[model samples]
Target: MSRFPLFAMAVLGLGLVFLYVPTLLVIATSFNESRLAGVWTGFSLRWYGELLNDRQFLNATANSLIVAGLSATAATALGTCAGLVLARHGRFRGRVLFLGLLATPLVLPEVIIGLSMLLVFVAAEQTLGWPAGRGIGTIVVAHATLAMTYIAYIVQARLTGLSRECEEAASDLGASPLRVLTAITLPMIAPAMGAGWLLAFVLSLDDLVIASFTSGPQSTTLPMVIFSAVRLGVSPKINALASVLVVMSAVCLGLAAWLQARRGGKVLPE
Candidate 1:
């Protein structure tokens, strides 16, 4: 049992293949000359050329990027605050209600969240005359609301594992609470914050239902466009787009990790 577990290795290999085989195939099919998936002709980049030229796809891509960036930033900010409060504070009045609000999005279905947000926006606009109409702003708010829970969970878990000795030592050294937070607390948790931001970005970029509910005319995100296209028929162009997204996600994560490591202050205190 202490030696190599042949059966476990076999299972792990199978699991990896099962998970990544389809992704590899999709990437390969994106370069295929054929429009269909099963029939792969010689390698070609026709679909990539077409996808870049597609006006609707370009517009949707822009919209998706804008929403993802704004939502991820907002979600991370709110979530970090929520996480700090939950993790640092002991029991307090209304703490249960506060926790419930933070956790609600994680438990509830996306469809329900989208619908509820839509309703809230509608009511607010009718009464308060803010937001005038649904569009990028509404989508950003919806995504932020739906995504902040995930960021909160990440930050909370990170904070839970972190040693508070650093902060305590800093306080004893005459640093104010805010100084300790800015210098010691924030640096230790920077990696988690970055990861949470990336996760939120991916969620907002990949979301379709919530975005659909909140999106107004001319505000369609990439997923919405892709969904609409898929309804008509699957094309190699979609595969091309998927490959692009996969590559872009990988690049972003890798770049963030590299930057974090380069900064060199995020390590946990011994």
Candidate 2:
């Protein structure tokens, strides 16, 4: 029994190392002076400097930020509403089927989602003569479709843990449902919403497959740029860019964690 416990711990440790050690190595190599990724010739920030000055990279970053922010906000709003209806109002006619449809994107292959969205855009352009062509709008819609599922899941979980007493109290005090929701309910679930927003943001920003299928030349996101660059060959610049992204993600996620902790250990409010 003791040997089995030791083996389990060993396996867990190995798993962690396998997952993270390479990432740490890549981060360390980003600072390496040598162009060859395998070699380290002292530490230098030259690659980082180069990345900062690269206009294409900067433009892609800006585009990514805009897309992530807009898509996440839209997704969070839609998901929050859906979650409220599902959790608080309970099951209604066709609700289960609707929820299953909503959740389909979460499990369906991303490539399929991307292709479907692309086909729809093409069809719309051909038939309705709208959208003009695919670009930022298309990407945003695709991202929002996927990201909303995450937000809905988070908000639904939050709603499940919430106490209805607060809203009841507000109603007893002559506050309307809208007023209670705008004031008490919104505040109570704000943490979960914030977390869901951040999660959506990350998902949108990191997405490559869906973006590739849906995006136009003018709307190429950071991941798309990275993918294109990598297709040519490995470059230290790519590593540098990846390190920057990893750092940004870490900082954003850390901030979200701190805020969540400060609000209370619970992901949802009561």
Candidate 3:
């Protein structure tokens, strides 16, 4: 173990530096008072103040949050059910097909998914005459579809680590299947469900391609706005926005961990 300790430590440190240095740099740049993002005149929250007052950015952020929340909720609900079925139900009919459908979105390129959604929406409007125009609802659905598979994968993996004994015991004690599901199964898998919801929320929030395809006029998301701003040039405000997102993501992960530690007591091994 001591033979190559220095080398192993060097490699680990190098990898962490490579992964985190850029993020650290971005966070530092966000506080730069200069109009240019890369230049650091002095530490200041000037850009953040500006960002807070920017109506367009705030609106886009609001849109992103709304879409992300709704999509994550929908994905969590659907994905939990799919995960339950795949993990618990044995040799169900069309299981292979169901898995194929779930896996397709995960493997498909984002551009393809976005374009396909666009085509489907256009076709639907042409035929069903519903969804008169693309907006938050369409974006929510697209994001949900894109994120659902990921949540299902997480939930299914978590379920695999769990023993079915509690559920079996509940059923043996005269609990109905529905009761077993609601009282025992769901609570036991609550940590995985929470983790899945966070994943879905982050996935939907960070998405650019799929959201762009489904978004209509006045439905721009934060990513879209950031991309457009980047096209012009990376400004201090954009850096501030990135920093805000970074902080938000960190807070979310911390919260999820805390919740898992609290709610996952004895259900699965730590």
Q: Cα-based RMSD of the predictions, in order?
A: 3.5, 2.2, 2.8
Candidate 3 lDDT, tens digit per residue, 176-247?
A: 999998998888788878877887788788899899998999799999999999999877788899888888
TM-score of 3: 0.91
RMSD of 3: 2.8
Model 1: lDDT of residue 116: 92
Give TM-scores for every candidate, taking all chains together and pairing residue i with residue i: 0.88, 0.94, 0.91
Best by lDDT: 2
Query: What are the lDDT scores of the predictions, listed in order?
Result: 0.86, 0.87, 0.84
Per TM-score, the best of the predicted structures is: 2
How many clashing residue pairs, candidate 3?
0
Model 1 Cα lDDT, one tens digit per residue, 190-235? 8878877887888888899999999999899999988998899878
- For model 2, where is the 10-residue window of minimal lDDT? 261-270
Better of 1 and 3 by lDDT: 1
In TM-score terms, candidate 2 sits at: 0.94
